[model samples]
Target: MALRFQNIKKKFGDLTVIRDISLDVGDDDFLVLLGPSGCGKSTLLRMIAGLEEVTSGEIHLNGRQVEHLPPSDRNMAFVFQSYALYPHMTVRRNITFPLIMREHKWWFHIPLVGYLAKRRIETKPDIRELVSITAETLGLTQVLDKHPRTLSGGQRQRVALGRAMVRQPAAFLMDEPLSNLDAKLRTAMRAEITRLHHRLGGTFVYVTHDQVEAMTMGTKIALLRGGDIQQFGTPREIYERPANTYVARFIGTPPMNLIEAQFQGDSLRIGDRLLPLPETAPRGDDRKVWLGIRPDAISLTTADAADALPVRVTLVEHAGAESLLAFDPGSLRVARDEDGQSDIMATQSGYSGIVAGDRVGLTLDIAQASYFDIDSGLRID
Candidate 1:
């Protein structure tokens, strides 16, 4: 289903959690709402699920407004951070619970034999087949008769997902559902969810604070902050071309480094060394600006480089294939200990050449660096 929000607003008491935000999820699109903690991403997801009431605006599924509809009537499934599985219920019962509820009439409500005699649900057989198929697909067949307490965290999560999937709603809303699992498990599950989305071919709106997950999992990302969306675009667009300094810093793995710089006519200077700005680099009107560069963009070397600033290598962290070295460029003033004496020293030229106290020339990737206005904190490039 095509899901859309128009002028959406959500308020908790007098505090507004969402403010006239508008967004859309095309059919089968995996859209991620990503941001830091307390950014209202989860609240937005809950609002979509009808768990949180919308203060104002319309939520449309296939061009039909469902904003005011109750959670059960919305035809959308939500998988929460906590799996919220029933400890005593078997996986089969868990997956079939929604179907059973829908099939049970007010007149048929009873204890012992009522469940078995529930007007012989026409969809019961279909639901059972679906539950089995989905459980098998998610590798939960072996544990179908077991309770949630007997399963691992990942297994429990799958059960919760299975329950949601059994409903077969118009769309799916997930809020950091993989967070309870460990790192490796999260990685594996992330791939699984992506694959599942592809197979299910349904609208998926996921909320997460993990930027890497946001970058890798989502077809598009809507970045939020302070109850409002900062920017919305495809992953590549948001990563390669962030709208502002925050996004530019947020998207990268090591995160973009923003160091103070002074513009010297055509060249940019971190301290005394002039950097060769890329032809496409944005020009900053600020005599002083922040030079934003990704760590991967800059190459470190022992040989003196012409465009490089001298750096003092203090620490090196090797992670299997790649090594991350912490260096103090000549422009930065930092405490350095040499021959047992710890003192504050500023590399005058930001030049590099030192294993300890001396400096080594460190080249900044000026071509890839972006200039940001220091005052407004907006990217110039």
Candidate 2:
């Protein structure tokens, strides 16, 4: 199902948590609401599920307004950060809980009668078949008879997913479902969820602060900050051409390097070095701009190479398959925090023999660089 949010706003007393947010999610699209904590990503998801009331505006599910509906009335499944499985129940019982709730009547609340009715319902061929299919699909058939306490973290998470899957809801709303797992398990589960999304072909609205998850799993990403969207686009579009400096700093590992420069005539002046502006960069005369260069785009060059900028290596980290080198751009002005000391990072494949304190010549790939307005922090196209 497709989702549309029109002028949505959420406020708590006097503080507005969500601004006038407006965006559309395509059907069967994996749209990830990515941002830091307290950015209203979870609040937005809850509003869609009807768990939180919208202060104003409308939410549409497949063209039907649903902002006024209750949680039970909305046909969407929510998978939370906590697995939220019933510890007392077996895996089969947990996965079958949604179906049981759907068919439950008033008499199902009576202790003795409820027990017999539930057993009978479980014995039904259709219910049994459905449970069996879901368990097998999630590789939980082997543990169907086990309780939650006996299962591994990943298995328990899968059970939670199976519970939601049994409902066959229009969309899957996940609020950092993999955050509880270890780094290794989170990676594994990320792949599993991506595969599940492909197989189910259901609309998924996921909320996460981790950029890795947003980049790898989402077909479309809405990057939010201060209750407003910084950029909304595919991963490549946001990574390659960020809407502003905020996004440029938030999306990458070491993040993009922002250097202070002067855009004059046909060249950019960074400190004492004058380099040709990127072909795609906006033209301006004596304008202050921020030049953004990705870590991998800067390469180690020979001292005699043309246009080579001299830098002093400050740190060298040997990560598997790549080396991250931090260098001090001697005369070039770089963006820094209150500490006033931030080195520019460059990535080199495999081991780079370069060490800290070593002076090296580096060449910036101007063709791959990005320029932004210094005052506004917005990209200069």
Candidate 3:
């Protein structure tokens, strides 16, 4: 089902948390709401689930207005960060609870009368079959009788997911569902969730503060900051061509380096060095500009070559298959280090022989660089 948010706004009296946010999530799209803390991504998700009220605007589910409907009436399953499973109930009971509530009348919920409810439920073959299939799909069949506390973190999360899956809702809303897992488990769950999305073919609206989760799992990402969306696009589009300096700084591991420079004719003046701009590079009348270069795009070498800018290596970070070299370019204010010194980064494959205090030459790929307006901080190219 297609999910649409039209000019959605949320306010907490004097504070406007979500400001005119609008997005269209296509059917079966894994739309990720990514942002830092206090960015209103969770609040937006809650509003869609009817857990939080929308101050203004509309929410449409499959072309039907649902902003005014209760969460139960919306036919959407919510998977929470806390899992929110019932500790007293077994995994089977927890997974089938939603189904029972929906199918059985209120009188069946009474303590003594619930015995008849159990018999009625066992008589219905579909509910039992669904619970068994969901348990097997989530690898929780062995733990179907186990309490949540007895299961591992990953197993508990699976039970939580199983609960949502049995509901067979039109869409799934997840709020940092894997935040409790360790790094390795998080990686495993990421793949599992992606596979589940494919198998179910259900629309998933996920919220997370982790860029790795957003980049790897999302078909489209809505990058939010201070309750406003900085940019909304595919992972590659936003990473390669960021809408503004904020996005350029936020999306990557080492982040893109932003060098303050002056545009002079066909060249950019960074201190005393003149870096020539490619013919295809964006041009603006403004003399001042922000030049963005990803770490992987800059090549560092010991030998000096034409068009190479000499730099003093400040630090070399070794991370498994890649190494990040932080350097001080002649006079360009690219990024700041702990010592308040300006630094730029170049990434190399595998381990590096380069060390701190080593002098190296950096060759920038002008064609791969991005230009932004200094004043507005908006991308120029």
Q: lDDT by residue for model 1 over 95-163, one digit each (tens)?
A: 777766656534344463235433333446777688889898788999998988899988888888888
Per-prediction backbone clash count: 16, 0, 0
What is the per-residue lDDT of model 2 for residues 332-354, given as tens digits with 9 covering 90 to 100?
78887435666888999998898
By lDDT rank, best first, the candidates go 2, 3, 1
Ranking by TM-score: 2, 3, 1
Ten-residue stretch with the least lDDT total in model 2: 105-114
Local distance difference test values of all predictions, in order = 0.76, 0.89, 0.87
Each model's TM-score, in the order given? Answer: 0.86, 0.95, 0.94
**Model 2 misplaced stretches (Cα beyond 4 Å):** 105-121, 302-305, 337-341
Question: In candidate 3, what are the lDDT values of residues 1-381, reduced to their tens digit?
Answer: 499999999999999999999999899899999998999999999999999999999999999999999888999999999889878778888888888777664645457344643664588789889999999898889998888999888888888899999999989999999999999999999999998999998799999999989999999999999889999999999999999998998899888888887888888776666877889886654388888888899997653666677889889999989998888776666655335656787899999998999888888787898888888989885
Off by over 4 Å in 1: 105-123, 284-287, 329-359
